[model samples]
Target: MITVDTVCALIAKKLGSKATDLTLGADTAFDSVGLSSLQIADIVYTIEDDAEVELDPSQAANVKTVGDLVELVETTRAAGAAA
Candidate 1:
């Protein structure tokens, strides 16, 4: 299972912001925090590069919320570890 905390932490790191500025629960949109389509692409590439895993394009689209992002990371990490 994924948690909002993990997703927010990664988002904060990617945005070069403090974790406190991001909360796990209640936040709905990623763009509100300044993440654009370009930035999201960058973030996805960075996640693949840093995490060393492949993401399904379809699955990536499912990552709209913080919980979804956390699940993506966890699933990607798990996939990487298995390989």
Candidate 2:
């Protein structure tokens, strides 16, 4: 299941050492944590692979933090299941 911790871990993995102080703050900026386009792409790819579902980039465009990302994944998964 996609939990907040799971999302944090994924983001942290992508951030590498830059995530040392990662607190999973609800309003934490992705850019502030050094999540570049490549990292975002990697995170998206990893999530898609693990969940076996295609995530629409538009849905994730406004995501700004670990919490937001987790919510996005959960909502996307739920929507996919309904479809």
RMSD in angstroms, all models?
4.0, 1.9
Tell me the TM-score of each prediction against the true structure: 0.58, 0.78
Taken over the whole model, the C-alpha lDDT of each candidate is: 0.66, 0.75
Best by lDDT: 2
* Residue 56, model 1: Cα distance from true site in angstroms: 0.1
Worst ten-residue run, lDDT, model 2? 21-30
In candidate 1, where is summed lDDT lowest over 10 consecutive residues? 17-26
Residue lDDT tens for model 2, 27-52: 66677777787887787678777877
lDDT of 1 by residue, 19-79 (tens): 4665545354577676778777776666666656678888987677665666687888887
